[model samples]
Target: MTQIAALRVKKPDAPSSAGLLASLRGVSKAYATPAGSFMALQNIDLDIASGRFIAIVGKSGSGKTTLANLLTGIDSATSGSIRIGGVALEQKSEEELTAWRGRNVGVVFQFFQLLPTLTVVENVMLPMDFCRIGQTRDRRPRAMSLLAQLGIAEQADKLPSDLSGGQQQRAAIARALANDPQILVADEPTGNLDSHTTLEVMELFRSLTREGRTVVMVTHERDLGAFFTETVELADGQIVAIHNGEARP
Candidate 1:
């Protein structure tokens, strides 16, 4: 038998054969302008399984951010369907979406958008406070644990300005994971860091997937593709190609 066939035979059956944590079907987004409607994305169809590490890559104006925004419910789609964890986000009210996003998705931005006055641990705890994820007494411990997981526990008491760029980014990631979200959406997460720091952060993301969290990152850096299990290429506001750990042409 072929190696691929043998491997498939040896694999265990999944608890659920649905094989998807989130999906977008024929999705499109457009913005109104003086001249006409500007389409940012068109007929996007994607399926992301649980625990998968996915990277969406494209140049500026490629609609990578728009796709991420739609997936995370940061913005509404102009049309089509977005289903997350079997819940159709497109139909939810704004308040419902906010609560759903807080419980289901964790977001990391390019800029380490931490408060200047707050300490690292405090900043991490703030998300839980906003989302009301857990009891007030447990929030600090949870934040500390997340920081420790990212190898930034020692810097928890320091201010964002006091830490190095990489450390601050780690803190931001810790904050994003504060609510133990099922999905993590990051936009250019390592864009500001040096090569070494980028590697460190990428490793952390890889580990998170091992713990069964789905991760979707938007990046222009092709070098970072190695860290992901799958890569989706976007161009002209549409998916151009998908690669599963294969060498790019």
Candidate 2:
């Protein structure tokens, strides 16, 4: 069966949870520039519950990506706190944060940053190799299964350069899921895709949420807001509005 069809079959039975998987409390990010300290985000508080689909929307320089980086531990907050899955992310050392993020947060980037020389399955397996997620005997099969789950199993043997843009993106998603992470963070994931491909990828994200993964995506596309259960709008480094218990505008 196709990935979409499989998702449809299993979605109804997926688990659900209350409360949050990650939260930001008075979080802010600032960088020192030639002029002075420039704040990219300010006094932000947000909660992302397990299995929720959230979209952070804003124009350029609105601090959407900065917020994502903080959540994923790529960058530290200038002040305030960030908690992920009940653990304080800011408390961990860089080494610990790296390992923790690999096991807990799966990240997808806009450009589908797959290794050009590696075959599709190899790219998916790379995360497992770095994180040492599963036993040596199990990694390949697990990667294959994940690729199959994303409906790209047939492309497993091909290099990333040989696949279509959408296929490469799907492979990247499969790589992100290699460790079965609880939270998925995406930065402008559909930015480089055509409308049809964007829909396909968004549908895949919906499927992931149905499987009880928390998905937080940053985008400027207001038309795609309906896909999210929560919408957080940012302007000038601050959260301007939050809409919950509703579809996108």
Candidate 3:
């Protein structure tokens, strides 16, 4: 218990009785597959507080990414409710969801989804353009600042292919933060990085929490559980446990 205590971050206090930053109540997701309807998630209930770093851990086909997608509005739930920052996802149209996602959610992909043709800074600015955030002239400076904060300012002008995997991932993270969203969802964010880079990215996420940003990450690496304030473990599309830090049951 002492070891686990040391590993976990000192998260911000829970919200004052009002509600959570995000809530999933009786959520289930199923996809139409050749083998009938495939259930990716079943009866998921989760509450994410603002300024908390949460790790969703599970093996392949454990519904980790599916949960992330649902939170980010990339995919809708088959049956149930998902509300983030007081906005109910089920009530929004696809077009409305897209616009809301641009301003409210930041998504980091596993494979560093930076555009190959655009420079790192340009890639970061793409989100701002799509969301129409701030003046066009201010977007470049904001992108550069984000890259600088990620310690990759020097790589800002380079193409994604020119950067290393870690650098590219940093740029992708910069792009994710382009709109300064309150919630950041990462799906297998460090799946392609080396151990050192993985730790670096994890620490970066911790720092974000310090700034009052909520981070939900889907990762299979239970060994990195120390960096999270909470852990949600899933198996065969069902949440088996949700506990604080390394206290698995």
C-alpha lDDT score of every prediction, in listed order = 0.80, 0.80, 0.82
Clashing pairs in 2: 225-248
Tens digits of per-residue lDDT for model 3, 1-249: 000001121222323334356677889999999989999999887766544688888889999899889989999999999987789999999999999999888899999988889999999999999999999999999999889989999998888999988899889888988887867889989999999999999999888777666678888875787888788888999888777756242
* Model 1, runs deviating above 4 Å: 1-17, 246-249
How much is 220 displaced in model 1, in angstroms?
Answer: 0.5
Off by over 4 Å in 2: 1-18, 245-249
Best by TM-score: 3
Off by over 4 Å in 3: 1-16, 247-249
* lDDT of each residue in 1-249, candidate 2, tens digit only: 121111010121223235545567888899999999999998887665544678878889989899889888888898998887788988999999999988877789999999998999999999899998769889889989988988989999999999988998899999988887766789999999999999999999988777666678888886786688777778999887776644343
The model with the greater TM-score, 1 or 3, is: 3
TM-score of each: 0.90, 0.90, 0.91
Candidate 3: deviation at residue 50, Å? Answer: 2.0
Q: Tens digit of lDDT per residue, candidate 1, span 160-214?
A: 9999999999999889888777678899989999999999989988877776666
Error of 2 at 43 (Å): 1.1
Instruction: Give the C-alpha miss distance for residue 212 in model 1, angstroms.
Output: 2.0
Question: Which of the two candidates, 2 or 3, achieves a greater lDDT against the reference?
Answer: 3
Clashes of 2: 1
- Highest lDDT among the candidates is held by which one? 3
